[model samples]
Target chain A: MIISEMAFFLLVTGALILTVLAPVVLIGLFIKDYFSKSIW
Target chain B: MTEFALDTQTALFIIVGFALAWIAFGVWLGRKNKSHEDFALAGRNVGYAFAAATAMATWVTSNTTLVAPQLTYQLGVWGMVGYSFAALGLLLFAPMAKRIKQILPQGYTSGDFIRLRYGRFAWAVFLVISVVYAFGWLVSLGMAGGILLEALSGLDYYIGMTIILAMCVGYTLFGGLRAVIATDFIQALIIILGVAVVAYWLIDNVGLTSIHTELSHAHPQLLDLLFPAAVMFLFNNIFFGLGEIFHSNVWWSRALSFRKNVAYKAYLTGGLLWLPIPIVTGFIALAAPQLGIFPASADMIGPAVASSVLGKTGAILVFIVVFSALASSLDSLLAASSDLVTQDIYHKLIKKNASDQQLMRFNRYCILSLGVMTWLLCLPRVATLGALLNFAGAFVASTIWPIVIGLYWRRLQGIFAGIAMAAGTIVGLVAYFWIGFYVAALVSCAVSGLICAIGVVFNKSQFSWHQLQENEQ
Candidate 1:
């Protein structure tokens, strides 16, 4: 069953976005963690 | 005409070959086991590649080979894709690894982290849930092994299971992490090559056109690369995988086995490497429709379907792959779980002054006892694979947030972390027996996330950044 080209594009785009965003989220969390350190 | 004959012989060869190599490697490393720490965590000097491969190989056990294809048989395209979500477990571990190593660089087990990160009340609750989770998982693999052997060798399930479990436990009991890692590298290599070969040959035998032709009408959903069911399961499967790796001693021990720098890259490399295995190996079951061979259980789809397509030879190849997969994982679990006993339960509590040599001796004895317990438990094969595993999934989901959030959020007070873990576990456990584990996990994750967020919001006290940097030394 051939997925509609439109659906194919959507899924591919979604997966690609996730793949890229996963690392970004990790890095972002790390940055947040770094800044939140105790002042003392 | 014997079923899985080719697979059996081919598998036997690979098993013997890998075991021999492992024996050689074990002998070289075995006597060097100077302490329980050396045996269990490799003195924390393992490199990225070894850590990554062992982690990937162990996580992708019989379930990937069995359940994933079974899912494909029914859920169609979503089955393998849903299973592929497991790779997220490895990828998600990367950041979690760095944070965990920083906070608890010398941590011995998952229990050790929970002990330091939370309170005894929470740790006790976590341990009960953990024991059940570990046994549930061990039994799932056991039941799968029993059924697989029954199918291939025509041997009774009990006999077949004993053989497989004993072989794995035997090697693992003596070798420690060094042995587990050495064998795992070989096992991982064999499994990868075997899966690729059968997949290539499968496409050749049935051809993609025929597969599409047969699958299009009977189960058109299989053809839809991203069907509705796949999307529905997408997030759940991801959480399931994440929960298992995130909270378990299995992954934590691997983290502890590596040098600090090696730990991070190992997780990253392991993540990327595992991404394609589900797609590569599990899709062969799509060819099941072409053969019209539907085993009563779907997890059996990979072995049965592959055997039919490649004939006896393919069956044997699968057996070898399964052997490698099972041994690699069982050994890792045995070694890691024994480490837990040595560190968390033994050295810490019973024998604070125990020399490293004395501790190593106790570890081997613990390995023997635990092996017997898991063996006796596996004898029954009580629950269906999916039900048993989903229940185990709930247990881990209970730990995920406390683990993930607690790692990054040091301001996380022990009380809040304790409440999050305990309350989430209570709710999840209640849901599992009353409702189902998936629902339990869903509720647990949501509730635990809220509790953890509340802890963050309140900010009673915070850990200094300098403390973490200093601890790494």
Candidate 2:
């Protein structure tokens, strides 16, 4: 029941990629909210 | 004396500088808070960006940054993956958040809903559970701050703990929920980017392939997907997380604070963003064996590894990131718990005719008092971060079924709900002491659910949903 090396690599790398995208999405939302005057 | 990653002076400088900056930011945000509603619920009109960030960041707590790595070091792959399942709590709460907004549009705390929906006995039971879990979490975060500073920079535990507690209480006193959320947005960014850099460094320098090979040869259990203890821990951790979010005012206050249409999407997005974080933090511990860096205690593994690999620069980075992580949740808890005491206990119980201005003033005092109480409790160090949290798991998990059923079902009566929580908590504590921390939440949730089912089946009266619309004095 050992996790394969490929699985381990994929888990960490996929998480990293998603982690990288978080700031982009958050800031983009902020910009959209700022323009719309909806950010309270 | 043990060698530290950063010298004491630099750590103190970073702490003082960040403390001043955040307190100033809080004061700036406080300018618009004209009423108790504005201070406690961010005017109950928070937007998607800040709402989403606060949800994500507050969830990221000492547990994710500190305990995730510690669990990974102790339980292997399952620990981190199991930790990530906590995101399910946030994800599932999205719909409930929407329901809460619709049901209790003017709700101040989770206590309001419980008291209105289930009456005094159930509300009393709920407040007890909430108080126990809140203090458990508050003390854990406080201890973690001291532990982290001590571990990374050779700072005194007492000083570090006091400074972090005072800093959070100071800002929360100034700005309330507005300060908590705004600071959380920035802290969220620092935490994400900090961990990403450290993980990337590890993968580049240590190489995952080599690290995996080392684990396979030396610590095969870490790579074992079906490791017995880890498997047992999986569901318990999920239940613990569910209970934490489901019953705590931390999430509920956020729900009430966000704009009409924002709670669901904000929580969904926050949960999605939060899902990968524990994995990134936990992966740091997997590299420890290869680096031959063992920590004095399991909880120190994350900081110890990062500081050792990246040297002085990394220590500062870890300090700032961890500080931000601790503060994000610490301030929210301070504000949320204070709101619980002020709105639920003080206004509803003692000061029924208190004005909005008076409530606002009392809430600030509550925040100050909670900080001092937490500081005094944290002075003793007590249990390891993980142990203290899991103990709270027993108490909070019992409220899970009661809260869920009370929300959607009409047949569950207040008396039965109160009994369910009380009996479930008793049984759960029995299991926690007799079995293990891994089984506490599972056993508690199960017992509570069973009682809720019986109550649902046998109870004759239907609850009117309109009762939740509690009017302010």
Best by lDDT: 2
Single-chain TM-score of chain A, each candidate: 0.65, 0.96
Q: Write the per-residue lDDT of candidate 2 for residues A1-40, one digit (tens) a residue.
A: 9999999999999999999999998999999999999989
lDDT of 2: 0.93
Name the best candidate (by DockQ).
2
Off by over 4 Å in 1: A1-40, B1-24, B224-230, B429-438, B464-473
Looking only at chain A, give the TM-score of model 1 against the true structure.
0.65
Give the range where candidate 2 chain B is weakest over 10 consecutive residues by summed lDDT. B464-473
lDDT per residue (tens digit) for residues B304-371 in model 2: 99988898888888898899999999999999999999999999899998999999999999999999
DockQ of each: 0.07, 0.94
List runs of model 2 lying over 4 Å from the truth. Answer: B470-473
